[model samples]
Target: MGVQLKSSSLSPTVDHILDSRRHNSCLTLDAVPKFACRVKYLNLLLLSAMPGCCFCEGMALSRLLLLVLVAELAAASSDVGFVFDGFTGEANLSLNGYAEVTSEGLLKLTNFTPEMTGHAFYPSPINFKNATDGRPISFSTTFVFAIVPVYPNMSGHGIAFALAPSKELPGSMPSQYLGLFSKSDNGQASNHVVAVELDTVKSVDFADINANHVGIDVNDLKSVNASPVAYFDSREGVLKSLQLISGEPMQVWVDYDGGEMKLGVMVAPLNKPKPQVPLVSFTINLSSIVLDEMYVGMSAATGAATGCHYILGWSFGLNRDAPPLDLSKLPKLPRQGSPTKRSTEVLAIELTLAAIILLLISTAAVILIIRRRKKFAEMHEDWELEYGPHRFSYKDLYRATKGFDEQNLLGVGGFGRVYKGVLPTSKMEIAVKKISHDSKQGMREFISEIVSMGRLRHRNLVQLLGYCRRQGELLLVYDYITNGSLDR
Candidate 1:
């Protein structure tokens, strides 16, 4: 993780204090800091469970530490910044806003089914440290998505990458808000919603500029900077406008530079560069509007004119010369939503239980390995076998049957398989009754065999030479018992 980023919903009170156009809004925070602090601390439990075992876990602590520091820094200096790349659930990532992994390798957001509203955000908070008080850090994000109309050639609303202070919006209108603003906050200046709207349907009320145009929304829905959706055609060294809801995977880039506090977007994949001219460019300062930290993620909605919103992949880079947005390197689309959701506290509990189970399993494994020695009866030096009835060594018996290979298998019994093996010392052939691990009645049968054979001393019947038991693998050594029980 290059830096920590946060994404979430807003409370009514905090929004009022930060909601102003003046360079200063007389802003003060009590709950934001407390919430940020609590969030940062809860994340540490993740590190305790994951002890850097694999590629994913190796960077868990450092990335979480960056989040913790940014949360603290937001309390000290109002400036904060964070970056997220891909929604593939690495680095303690979870779904926040309104999205779920749908189907095998597919991230279906918004309306995967009918009558649905969806907003998905990264669990982390995004805070950019700016050079000036009113300026924001230069940030860029690239998201790959596909918009499929519920009915062919018909789609409503679209998606946006938003920076807000909270993870949820209560009762937000589904049609116009794009699931971005709540019912009380819609059309209100105090909304604190900054987004690059990808409008697909023309609206007189929203002043969409036109259908399929990219527009930057400030505190409200109207676009301060709007442009027809287009992509850089590097092959022709030119620009071309394209329909956003064309039912194909499309890429959109959002870049904000601190020099002028301007934001830019491009509609092309990683193969194409950020064009010299932006699809939409507007000037503004996040420092003036954004709270101490903001949640950054994608939001999409489908109303009566519905479409299925999908996020194939996503990434973000904040502050200090972050790398160019690359869509090629992302993993496959989501297979299914997280078994548990993190926006709620349930995710932490799930991970905690899984970690505990893992620890218990590992401890049991360690104990078993220590106790696994003396596998062969001959390997047990202190055990007496010479006085017994021609006791056989485990390893010698194993070799006589080629490590209990299937070819030497004589027949299948209720408890286990009987394999043909020749005694090493006596050169006498034998049928070994082996108790398998998966046999449901194996333990009961093994006890019966041991008891029944121990009491008998008949020579005419198959003599019980000896028995071996170690780590669930039980074998009864007897005289050449029932040779060739099965032909093949």
Candidate 2:
């Protein structure tokens, strides 16, 4: 009834409409002409069969993917830049400013004129420019000051960084505004102040700054109760002085990220790129400051007493914040009794001398042993001749001594065992000594005793009546001593 068409073209149109309806089920198939429906349907089937042909769906999906990608990119960028606070690289700041105090007045800067009054005012402040784009950065400052002739009972003043509303740092403000002037003279007038004080003069037990000491104050410029962080001499005990000494340059750095701030201070030798002194690093929350840009510089003032302070140089970085200090760059230390070349040489000499001494000792021992063997051999030969072999047969001695009966034993000596015996031929009582086969000193001692006694024939001396030498066995016959031995 509605004019149906069944051509091949209409088949495609119909397929198109059908496919569209399947994709979006609310599509109105009735709204399409019959012929166009078939064509639309065919087109839809072809498009559906294709790899990527969903127009509206693809557009919507692409948009969602793009949003996700954008979010990921933003997150990545936020983490891509400088991430830490403190002096990272070789960047540093130097101190070369002037500070003076007088008895009746202090130096003041106003109207292009300099005047001296009892009131102390910083003449020049060390200027530190942030060469970086206007990004909040972290910064720290440290300086050395030496009090002349060191005041014993006086409490010292404080130090400050003046980011004043204006560049013209005038002398009239109270110490509370900027600790450039004495806080004792004026009570907390300057609320826009940040100060770090080294209050050595306030504490009676505090050590002198001139004697390798320093104090650090943060945020409380005028209050005496502001406890300070302190630094003291290293083991070397070298006092740091602020009068532009060769090694007194103070190193300061400011590091800033979007939401973080850090400051660091280091003491370095003049003309050196590396800092050789102790370093202090700190962080501050910068969310409260209204300004995104700031000027960094330092100011100091001496009291009625005479003193001096100095600054060297300053540097800054932008967009890129400072990373944490490597700290490993500080210095290489020495160890006790390190094996230096000199020490090695000394040891070598000592070893050589010791080796020579040992060689001499070993040679002496060998020679002594050789000579002893020769002497022993000579004595043994002489003993062989004098005592004669077959002096006493084994059977004869055994029978005479009653087979070495214990009761027949006369005594003992270091050389051998002695026993009473009666010689069969001479019909005389004699002492017989039987040498032990295994004694370490047996051969030499036996030979010596035999040879010595064999040549002697005295009434007082024991007679070497005769001896037997056979098969590593020895027997000695001597005139008997009735009164025991000489020791007894």
Candidate 3:
């Protein structure tokens, strides 16, 4: 597939070059150098034809051609500028010291290891200056990083985004020097280093503004310009302070304009949009500090009080805005040890307590159910089995009479209250009499008399079915007469 751009009569030659690169895939990496040369000569020819029209037209077309060339170069192994969401399986980085690509795909600079210095650089050097005039060109870079200290308030040295002539910086010291320079060569011009530092610990010799600040350094650890870590909130239109050792990820943007010769540094919480105002801005010419060809990389160091420094994602552009990082895809930061561990233990303990409470509630419910079942239990005696005319249980008789309810009452006599009911199982109608007895006489004697009386059945008289004895009440069951009550 190829892209097509509308051709204009303003410049036919420029349109031809654009068409050839888009429709024809022949302008590969090998022909890039030759193609670029041809564009330069064509620019002169266009300007000679029409002075004013060709000047503006040629310049605009040149920018378009430059974007195409840069896009092609970024796809190659040796990129002028690149973007890395993570470092996993990446072969373009040269790492040293404690630097490594973690299993979580983080570019770890300084780990929990103390007194260590680490450096990681792009495999190839980038052309920072113009070929015609040796002046530093405009560049922009942005990265998401984090500084996690062992203690809450304490931290080691810091980290820096550095551009050096060589990939490796020999004889650099850790701690306050920031792995960029030693005490002896602190301000030497021959060092030729331009760096933007995210310093966590202040050094008196370097005249650091505070323990946490972003600084711009050239050929020395002493910052030429520095400001506390903060971002300008466009919505609220105010500045907010940030903590470096809070173990949270933050994003930083460093942009330099060679035309105005201004350098600006800005920082905000991770996933936030870039701030409109820069935290630290200074007027400085990097031409003297940065060489023609320089390696862009990061450097970090740890003193006695160490911490883990990580780079989650990075993007850089030579003369355009760096591509924005996809925050959702970046690797997650490692969990803090002490706080995370304690929280986990507390969660487990809470779950165990809840389970125990649930089990206790379940056991108590079962015991209550068994106790309630026994409360309504029917009383049975072995002696009652001897004399019986189908002795109905207390529970069955109680149910037949609907618990001797007043509503089912047939009549009330001096001996007891008689109630009319139907047997649940046999569907036979009957009348039950409930009489209160407080006698200490033998229960078998009373049951025997009642059983014999129940056997005396006649056609004209009501038949006695059975008798039941409970707590302090004696119940008698008889056939229900549907005609009329004797008293009525």
Model with the higher TM-score, candidate 1 or 3: 3
Best by TM-score: 3
Q: Which lDDT values do the candidates have, in the order given?
A: 0.63, 0.40, 0.76
- Give candidate 2 regions above 4 Å deviation: 1-159, 169-178, 181-190, 196-200, 203-219, 222-259, 268-283, 289-293, 318-488
lDDT, candidate 2, residue 143? 26
Q: Rank the candidates by lDDT, best first.
A: 3, 1, 2
Q: What ranges in model 3 sit over 4 Å off?
A: 1-79, 336-488
Query: How do the predictions measure up, each by TM-score?
Result: 0.50, 0.29, 0.56
> Tens digit of lDDT per residue, candidate 2, span 88-188?
22222222223322221211111111121112212222112221233343333222222221222232233344433223334433222223343332333
On residues 1-488, what C-alpha lDDT tens digit does candidate 3 reach at each position?
Answer: 00111111122354545554444323333433322343453443334322234222455665565556555543331224677877686536888888888888899999877788899887666666654455667888898898887767788989999998877788888998878888888899999898999999988988898999999998988898999999888788888899887778899999989788899999999868898778888888888777756888899999988988889888887666776777887888876324334445777899999999999999999999887566446446787667554577766766777877888989988888889888889999988888888773786777787778778977766777787776777878887888655233
| Candidate 1 wrongly placed segments (more than 4 Å) | 1-86, 89-98, 112-115, 129-134, 321-326, 329-488
Best candidate per lDDT, number?
3
C-alpha lDDT of candidate 2 relative to the true structure:
0.40
The sequence of per-residue lDDT tens digits that candidate 1 reaches over residues 82-166 is 4434443343344544466643434666664444567777666666544224457777777777776654446778887888777
Clashing pairs in 3: none
The local lDDT score (0 to 100) that residue 171 gets in candidate 2 is: 49
Lowest summed lDDT over 10 consecutive residues: which window, candidate 3? 1-10
